[model samples]
Target chain A: AQTVTQSQPEMSVQEAETVTLSCTYDTSESDYYLFWYKQPPSRQMILVIRQEAYKQQNATENRFSVNFQKAAKSFSLKISDSQLGDAAMYFCAYRRGGGGSNYKLTFGKGTLLTVNP
Target chain B: DTAVSQTPKYLVTQMGNDKSIKCEQNLGHDTMYWYKQDSKKFLKIMFSYNNKELIINETVPNRFSPKSPDKAHLNLHINSLELGDSAVYFCASSQGDRVRGTQYFGPGTRLLVL
Candidate 1:
């Protein structure tokens, strides 16, 4: 069994600033995947970025990048030049890399990010 | 075009009633899943199907049935609904269960059981 934890229940960032959401997970498997998902008022889940456990280099997409620390089991999402549109609920998820029961995606209780413009 | 879509974006039903939610993906992905989001915004897995074969069936109750007509579609049918069954259901698809591949999500269907 694997569990993901998001320490921040709520976070606020000023417009044009930077914000980082923290996430950690517990898994015995060596191979896995970490992800950040965003849900806006429309209730649509959008992929922010994904990081492979084997890849030490963090994943970056536009304003979103992650500090993936395999040892500490920490995967934090950083949003730079934050805008009002970035206000949403963010979730950290984990999944097994190999085939079998680990194929399913597990999510953490979301962190509410409020971007004040 | 929406890559993954779910029908009946909003569902309102009475207790003990039976209802079904349909999901379809045009991404040509071979794997699909059904996830439930509670009032607290906690997303949990309900079921998953790969290539039309049942794979991950969480601790979901027997009343909640998932049917996959083909590889591209997975439908969720719930029987004897309770107020606790009220939540937002999301449909997602992935090329495969590979680590590098990402799962695309659909606009969730909000179910309100009264």
Candidate 2:
């Protein structure tokens, strides 16, 4: 079984600043997918960014980027130019590369991010 | 248009009561899934359906039942709900391709069992 861990229970970042949320996972699969999801107070989960294990280059989406280290089993999310809208509960998820049950996502407990103005 | 939707955004029921949460997807995806977010905010997969067929059934309790009447709708019926059953239930959909497709999730229904 694969388990994702978010060591930081809470994180705070000032507006227009940058912050990073740490994430680590335990999985034996060579090829997999890592994802960061944001859940606002509205309870809607939104995809922030995704990284493929095979890709050496980190994935960047707008102000959201990921530092994916396959060897260390670490996948951290970096929020740049953070805004008030970035305040939410961020989750790190892992998914196997293939179809069927392998596609099921294993999510981390979540890190509550607070953006201060 | 909403890609995925779930009814009763908030549900409050007494223990031992039976309740059903309905889910529908407007996207033409072939796979749908039900996920549970516990109090600690740990999200886990409970059930998954593909094209009206049951695919992945996690180690969920028998009190929880998932029914897919069609490819676009998957409803969850919980019988004799308990206090431990209180959690936010999310419905999601994705393409059934060999490659892992991105899943679109619903807003989620918060169930509170008293």
Candidate 3:
């Protein structure tokens, strides 16, 4: 079974600054997908960004980017130019490549991020 | 238009009561799933259905049952609910393609079993 771990329980960052949320996973499969989901106080799960294990280049979406290190089994999310809207609970998820049950996502506990003005 | 939606955003019921939460997706996706977020904020997959067929059934309790009348709708029925069942339930759907199919989630149903 694959497991994702977010060591930081809580994190805070000043407005316009950058914040990095650490994530590490355990997977024996060579090909997989890693994702970052943001859950605001509204409790809506929104996709922040995603990274494919086969790709060496990190994935970036606007101000959100990921540091995907397949060798270290680490996939961290970096939020640049952080804004108040960035305050939320961030989760790291892992999904094996392929169809059927392999598509099921294995999620981490979560990291609550606070953006300070 | 809402891609995915869930009814009864807030559900407050007593223990031993039965409740049902409905989920629908207008995205024409062939796959739907049910996930449970515990009080500790841990989310886990409970059930998954594809094309009205049960595909993945996690280690969830038998008290919880998932019904998919069609590919666009997946409803969860919980019988004899317990306090431990109090948590936020999320309904999500994704394209059935073999590639990077991202799952889109609903607003979530907050269930409180008192």
For candidate 3, what is the DockQ-based docking class? medium
Per-model TM-score on C-alpha atoms: 0.98, 0.96, 0.98
For model 1, the DockQ equals 0.71
The parts of candidate 1 lying over 4 Å away from their true place are none
Cand. 1 Cα-lDDT: 0.93
The positional error of residue A6 in candidate 3, measured at the CA in angstroms, is 0.2
Give the fraction of native contacts in model 1: 0.77
Of the true interface contacts, the fraction found in model 3 is 0.60
lDDT of 2 by residue, A52-92 (tens): 89899999999988988889999999999999999999999
Q: Which stretches of candidate 2 lie over 4 Å from their true place?
A: A99-101, B98-100
Task: For model 1, state the Cα shift of residue B94 in Å.
Answer: 0.8
Clashing pairs in 1: none
For candidate 3, the per-residue lDDT at A18 reads 98
Model 1: per-residue lDDT, tens digit, B1-114? 989999999999999999999999999988899999999999998888888988889989999999999998999999999999999999998877575358889999999998
Tens digits of per-residue lDDT for model 1 on A1-117? 899999999999999999999999999999899999999999999999999998889999999999999999999999999999999999999988886633778899989999997
DockQ of candidate 2 against the true complex: 0.66
Give me the runs in candidate 3 sitting further than 4 Å from their true place: none
Model 3, span A1-117: residue lDDT tens = 899999999999999999999999998998788999999999999999988888899999999999988899999999999999999999999888865643778899999999999
User: What is each predicted model's overall lDDT from 0 to 1?
Assistant: 0.93, 0.93, 0.93
Model 3 error, position B72 (Å) = 0.3
lDDT of 3 by residue, B20-84 (tens): 99999999899899999999999999999988989889989999999999999999999999999
